[model samples]
Target chain A: MNMKKEKQSGCGRSEDLVTYLYGEATPVESSDFERHLKACAECRDELTAFQSVRGTLRQWEMETVPPRIDIAIKPTFWQTVKELFAMTPVWGKLAFGGVGALALLALFNVSVTVGGGGVTFSAGWRPQPVQVVTPGTVPPVVNPVTPVTVRTTDEAAVRAIVAQLVRESEKRQAEQLDAKLVSLTSKLDNRQRAEFVKAVSQLKQDQRLHLASLIQENSRRGGPDLLDLIGQVQSASVEVEE
Target chain B: MQTLETTDMQLVEQTLGGEPDAFGVLVRRWERPIYSLAYRMIGSDEDARDVCQETFISAFRNLKSFRGESKFSSWLYRIAINCCHSRQRKQPQPDVSIDEQIEEYGLEPMDSRESVDDRLYRDQRAQLVRRALAALPHDMRQVIVMKEYEGLKFHEIAEVLGIPVSTVKTRLYTGLTYMRKRLEHVSDSL
Candidate 1:
């Protein structure tokens, strides 16, 4: 028991001396530790030995930097979609093929309507019969004359008239689309324009909201108050009128 | 635009706010001490680098859960120590040859005659020290490495290992006593 007590006391002294050597002791503790070390050769020698070991360990420095790591970034919607599509199996592509066929059929119906063709559509796979207008619904004839029955000549003339009508309708539709695109493009800044293109291509609702929020945030940060925005809009209106 | 004095907490907040590059500054600052701790604990440069990288990756992934209760460096050191322990548990014991151990101790046939005997004595002492260190249990070896090589305080080590301070001190004392006996044997051999 006495030997155990002596060993405990010696261990405590050694720990104190180690702390003191590392400059972690208080002033009073340092004084007591120094007094103990001055009398105890064993503690003093142990401290020196540990210090040498520490010095040698310090020599083993890592000569190279750790390897580089890739950081995770928030991927854009299109980027995620591309990744998903790339990993999609052949069966998935076939399922998408069915959806594409339905979409194409819908697009053809809309195009036929816009072109004012005599074609009628149904939900069936085959084309339905076209509708003909009643003779009473036609405009009244101003003059009574014998209708010319030039078979080949009349077919060529009808084809020419149909082609001209289709071209005019297409020109009108193109002009309207161009105007809408121009207006939308003019309202957006460069960054917003890029975001808008990305949102449309990716078909993501969140991206659209994000683009809108970014525009509002930029306008707020531009130091433009409500009065300034109104003034700018009013000036733009006046310039358009001029 | 804020010119406030940057603290680790602030850097951590910035990193949590999606500024990943901000954490790179922390990595650059603490990589050396963390690498040193790992290297001393595992005694392999390659594994130490792996530990450092793994530590940073884990710290980054879990930064939001830090809770600001402890110093960032202390948290990082704890992660590194845990990584080292897990690695030690997974790796099979290395087959260390006696000749390689002697060579690591700088013991070999000497060419010069004047200081040959003294060189042999020093080599034997080094070999004894290495053997004693290897003989220690993993826990005891870890405590010794942190205390001696990494210079962590007893309380800090306890915090890192989640053990009591007394346990840390006991392990250190036990490890050193073992080394002292081995050194005495080396002296007898000389």
Candidate 2:
């Protein structure tokens, strides 16, 4: 239709066509354009074509049911924490890391005293002097120059403790020996029962072989021993079934 | 206050104020339009979905830069446009062109209808329109899709694209003329 007028004498109204078509133009602009529309068949035709295109455009629509779009939004706290690390400056991260490490060290410094022993630590804990427990049989050394960390052992206490430990060891060894003897006896009983079953099975097998041999030999010899051989075979078959 | 009826600005404020689900609320509000925009712009469902996802992520990342100067949706549309542009540059075309898609899906019925022929006719028209839209230049295509399909106003489209409203009108008009010619030609051929 624009070819019909060949650009409407360079009407310079092309841009307004979309605005007017979309009803975005003001009423004054609409009235003026309406005057122009009455005279310009080119604009009218083009506008008509555009309006039809808009109708045709409706054919390509978004799915009636809106599609599910996945855009991750983590939990508030998690996002904050993530952004805290991500958005933080290097110096800020370093400062935070330093404080975190120190706080962790201080928290770990809390020690529980067990049996007067220092908790195992390498950083700031000092080793305390532990009193030596021993039997007091010998006289204490009188070395004035010795360090305070060293203390004399009680020989009598040491002897009594050693004797008690020896007696406990002997009792424990006796208990272990009793347990071992019971286990061995149980194993021996099982083996003996198994051997008895094996011997009985062997005897049955030998009896069956002897009966079959008797049947074969009697059949060759005569009919007199036939009843005895038959009796023996029946007894062997009964034993096998049993 | 942060219900479904909350304004986009309020939700943006909540999101910026460290309310994470508020951003989720925003995503739910705008993802469909953004997807539609990207889909029409790039003509690929998968890439359009990708563009939709990246648009929100970039918006969330750059929420501070939003500054409330324009509408939050304008800001979101701006991100979506940038994503679609970069995506288009990276791929230069859809994963499958309109012809390939038509060949594959056979203009399947878009919705439940009374008769098969009506559905078929409607779907063919849609397919022709999609091919026309996809064949248009990117600048004209974005303007037309934003205006006709997504229903963004002229000023809103201008704001999102960082262009003047008159340019949007001209591009939209030219784009529609091209589509009219293309659709006519295709129908004549058929």
Candidate 3:
């Protein structure tokens, strides 16, 4: 009964049985455990059982081959860039996000023009209303609520001044065009006259040469140059005979 | 090259010195033992393979953190064990069904030339042993596997597990005792 209790609830001696079974006990520990084992059937049986268990466990041979393990110590630079962007602080992300959003708004043609219309914010687009003024009436430039009407005399005077300015502008443009046309025409006439004079002089020179040749031919044929004419005929006849 | 490659510490230094192939040398050297350790601990070929991969990757990533206090193998075993624990936490497998116990441990069909009876008997006994080991508590199983299968010394197991040597021996004893009872029961059933 005492042995059973010691076996069931051991002192630190149980661990020695393990150390001894696995052969890890020191020589002194081994000799002491051996002495103890000679007396203790429990330790001996337990040692035997554990050895049997280890034997059974060792029978499991794993024939499975290990697959090759490759570690990429350095990730791709693109992945590094992604990690860098991912490490951005929340405020930085939000700031960049805001900038990106503004860029998107700009891409969508959302324009904010500060005009007399008190800041026009158009999404797609809305054209401003067009106004027409009669001949005697001077309307406001862009105001619809209040029309600043001028007296007839002022309106007429402004109209008269505008018409006068328009007439002066037209007259200046017409005069400029007329002077250009006249100068061009004069240049064309001078060029034509020079060409015509050259052509006439050339024609007269040719006519004079022809008349002199005619006269020389006439002189050779009958008028005091019969010797040259007889030589020409005789040379022609000799060539014909040869 | 064999003469030049002296030790794990040398490989580690070479790896740290921007020679990545040196790490490859280390991986090739240790992959099998680490894989075996993982397989024995988890009892699954596929998960063990994953654990092996994760262990090496973790080691390579944190190679600078290794203090050289333990053997490089012990340090690697520590990482592999941690990865197994993490994987267990992430995905707890269902208990091996009694009908599927043979399939669980057989892993691959081996020895086509053996008589059906002999193969069946051998595979059945192996499967029973595996079932028992699988049933062991994780801590005890870890100790048993390190001591019995991996042949790690008691102190090495202790160093890897970061436990006292007494604890390791105690765990080994308890684990072996439990395995004995389980095997006895299995033998009786057979």
Candidate 4:
């Protein structure tokens, strides 16, 4: 028994004999552990206990299965693009490219229209009126020598012509006003622009009052006939102006 | 070198060669032990299943990078251990109340005394073991789980965890000693 005890102690190192009992020991360690277990009651009891613990642990099982996963393959850059294109049907590819081409074409059409400064509309058969600016109608070119005012002979005809001319002049004036406002806002210093805006606002208020007074005076004198004609003319002129 | 001899390089090579089914065979071979290790470590069936899935998925993704430096099972065990670590870190601290812990660990309470009392007692002892296992520190628990459930050698566990074999032995001894004491404590309480 003394020899057997010595043999057991020598064969299995108690340090990791527990691991050996669980079958985790190396082959050499397993051999020694088996030899040691046969001879020593103490070591053999320890092994049995460790084995029981291990057996109990083995009874524990996970109740569920893991989820399945597909590993994504990393494709080359060109292969990625190729795969993207491949995923698209032929008609879809054509549609994508076609939409891009259509966008470019629309952009080109807009550029051409902007460069020409006006849109051309076809009337199917007859050409619509294309108004030409008569030199007499255009404001004198801001030169000192050019007359600011001019005279006409036939009062009614002159009034009608002047009304037509005034309507045309006001339309041009409105376009110039828009352009001037844009330019002034962009170019003028802030203080100067503010002052200019105040002056222009005051002038518009004064002009509106003057026009109202004139309309009142004409209604008093002409018994609303002149006012009615002026109203009709103004309505007609607005449609043409637009 | 011995690890290289045991590593599943052949299986991996076969897997990479369009034999995806080869991996399923590997799964079938390792699943029970892997699942057992996960279940023992986490003490929750749901979390253990998650760890097992993540382990295989990670192993599959990094299969190409495995250079046969260690055994495939060791590598797989390492992945599973790391997964369990992360899972534990994410979990809120479990209630230390014995009843709560027992219930959370899936231990059913004993009812009327029956002829199956012996089997029930054994099951309760297993649950007690599991509680003791869960009570251990993360480092020691890892060594015990791998050694007991996964059956990794001291050197192999050390290799998987990248720790010294002596440290592994120390932890195993400490863990087992703790288990014995805890088991005795539970028995006395009953």
Candidate 1 recovers a fraction of native contacts equal to 0.06
Off by over 4 Å in 2: A1-9, A75-242, B1-4, B94-116, B186-190
lDDT of 2: 0.73
Candidate ordering by TM-score (highest first)? 2, 3, 1, 4
Model 4 residue pairs with clashes: none
lDDT of 4 by residue, A1-242 (tens): 11111112233465757556556678988887688778778777666665555555554443345334333445457756666888999999999899988786655542221112233222222223222334568743644575343221123343455577789999999999999999887776675656544543544444446546656877787655433444544565457559
lDDT of 1 by residue, B1-190 (tens): 9796678899999877656668888887778888878876776779988898889888988898898887788799989988988998898555454344545654332333534686454544444454555555667777777877677887888887888876776666555554443343343333
TM-score for each model: 0.48, 0.55, 0.54, 0.46
lDDT of 3 by residue, A83-141 (tens): 67799999988998899899888676475654323444555433333344656778547
Candidate 1 deviant stretches above 4 angstroms: A1-14, A38-45, A55-242, B1-5, B94-135, B180-190
Q: Residue B29 CA error for candidate 4 (Å)? A: 3.7
- Pairs that clash in candidate 1: none
Q: Rank the candidates by lDDT, best first.
A: 3, 2, 4, 1
Which runs in model 4 stand beyond 4 Å of their true positions? Answer: A1-242, B1-7, B17-24, B94-123, B185-190
Query: For candidate 1, lDDT tens digit of each residue in A119-212?
Result: 4323434434333323458843433374323222233345556779889999999999999998877876565656545534553455445445
DockQ, candidate 2, vs. native dimer = 0.23
RMSD of 2: 31.9
Worst 10 residues of 3 chain B by lDDT: B106-115
lDDT of 1 at B25: 81
lDDT (C-alpha, whole model) for all candidates: 0.64, 0.73, 0.74, 0.65
lDDT of 2 by residue, A47-153 (tens): 88778778778878664444676666666666668777989999999999999988877665533332212232233334344344445656456556964442122
DockQ of each: 0.07, 0.23, 0.25, 0.07
| Residue B15 displacement (Å), model 1 | 1.8
lDDT of 2 at B43: 72
Indicate the residue-level lDDT of A87 in model 1: 89
Candidate scoring better on DockQ of 2 and 3:
3
